[model samples]
Target: MRGLNDKVTLITGAAGGIGRSLVRRFLEEGARVVALDLDAAGLADLETQCAGHAGLLRTMPLDITDHAAVQKTVQAVHAEFGRVDVLVNNAGWDVAKPFVETTPELWDKLIAINLKGPLSLQHAVVPLMLAGEGGKIVNIASDAGRVGSSGESVYAACKGGIIAFSKTLAREAARGNVRVNVVCPGPTDTALLRSFTGDGEFGQKIYDGLKRAIPLKRLGQPEDIPGAVAFLASDDADFITGQVISVSGGLTMHG
Candidate 1:
């Protein structure tokens, strides 16, 4: 949480469950936030929610999957905010279904949101970070990436790609003092998770099974994530890079 005051932070997926939580947390930490999301209405509501925060909030309507659009936004953000201090790649989408049962169209959407969007953002932001002399990039991947998840083969692949990409980028960006790392969430109760689990008995069964499987006897909450994310984005994590931290309530662990 240290050294975050007045920092220029950009977060994608700014309207969703975890994304909104991250925005609120960063603002509370006194960071100037550039909240980006495709949901303009949600961004407006988020701005209202951020009324009394010490830091400033600027919302932008953006589709992360659009490469040229991402570049333009990054440039515009830099022009307005002066420089970006941190970038949180949190926008992602997917549906739960067996790989064979899933269609290529779904695969395209999965790759575009989960993989390509972050890739494009990184491509645009890293240079600005290099020019600014330093920055932090905290990618929100998934435990599915670390330890595969059923009904999420393509999504897991995209997340796994993110894990690999972050480490490589961290190593390459170290000379510029630009740190990169990943946070992999477990079975969090979010809108996306609701979509993953169908209604009634099916959803309950999956949710209960996850609780029983996890070392902790409950599903993860959206609020449980931002602390780790903020830590990674703050100066407290100056020495930590190329690492993947799992926020999965002990459901996933690495030595």
Candidate 2:
């Protein structure tokens, strides 16, 4: 959490479960945050929730899949803040279904949101970081990408691509002092997870099964994520790059 005070931080998917938590954490650490999300109403709600830190937060509606828009937004942020200190690529979307049952349309949406969107943001922001003071990039992937999830084949593929991309980008950008890393969450209790498990006995069965399978015997909470994310984004992780940390409560582990 060190060296985050007054930092210019941008977070996508800022209206969602984990996204909101990330926003609050950064504000608490005294960072200036530009919260971006497609859900304008949700962003408003988040703003109200953090009204005490009004000057520290600004919410913007954004569709990360739009490349040109992403570039413009990054430019706007740099114009206003002078520099981007941290960029968190956290926006993602998915619907759980078997691979064969899923359609190309769903695949397109998955790739656009989970993969291309983050890539677009990085493409825009990295140059700014390289030109100015260096920055940190913390990408939110998934345990499904690291291991596998039964109903998320395409989503997992996109996340896996993110993992690979972050490592390569880290290596490429290290000399410039622009650090890149990944945080993969597992079975988190988010709206996305609830959508993944629709209402029914089947949903309950999947939920219970996951709880049982996880060594911690519970699903992950949004709050459980920011500590690791903020750490990586902060100067404390100055030496750590090209690494993937699983914040899955023992659901996934790597040596």
Candidate 3:
């Protein structure tokens, strides 16, 4: 793996499970990271956790769904770091309910967070990447998007849209030396998973059922994801673009 020494990386949802893992991993790899998330307290906690690594990490609290806020945050990142070489669109939200129960309000929220957020981030960052001559973008999608999932109709749809958007953006941006790709994590052990499955015994039962179906016999850790993100964001994946790599512990396969 190529070292990211001095590289500037921006990761949205940086206060969340997978996002926080990615931020730490990238910093460990010697990159300067701009961490963006909606959770102010979480972001502050992460800042404290990474305090010893001065100049290596900067936390920005922002709502990705807000276009103006995203633009401002992107600008601030560039101002702080001078350039952004990697953009990880890792922020997302979902609602778990039967398709019949999914109202338009819920549908809009899913799309706004999962699809539009990434779109907004890309809009705000790509030009900066182009201006800097090159960059990488990795969208953290889900296997639920690839194969569909119960109680995640709108969520799946939004994720699927991310996959499609990444491909198109990859093709369009290649000439500018920008690479775009998607990482589809399957049933990861994240706060979002807990929220989706509900509380206590009921959640454990649902998790256990999913675990039994996965060939790896377990859920993935947030740590399991950053390696793929790091690889995709590094020179090692320079020739790779418009691809979907499933980090799902063999939970799903695509030909």
TM-score of each: 0.98, 0.99, 0.97
* lDDT of each residue in 135-183, candidate 1, tens digit only: 9999999999998999999999999999999999999999999999999
lDDT of each: 0.94, 0.96, 0.91
Count the clashes in each prediction: 0, 0, 0
Least accurate 10 contiguous residues by lDDT in model 1: 47-56
Predicted structure 3, TM vs. truth: 0.97
Instruction: Please identify which of the two predictions, 1 or 2, would achieve the higher TM-score against the true structure.
Output: 2
**lDDT leader:** 2
Off by over 4 Å in 3: none
Error of 1 at 149 (Å): 0.4
Clashing pairs in 1: none
lDDT of 2 by residue, 1-255 (tens): 799999999999999999999999999999999999999999999999999999999888999999999999999999998999999999999998999999999999999999999999999999999998799999999998999899899999999999999999999999999999999998999999999888999999988999998999999999999999999999999999999999888988775
Report the Cα lDDT for candidate 1.
Answer: 0.94
Query: Ranking under lDDT, best-scoring first?
Result: 2, 1, 3
Tens-place lDDT digits, model 3, residues 34-74: 89999999999999888877679988789988999999888
Instruction: Rank the candidate models, highest TM-score first.
Output: 2, 1, 3
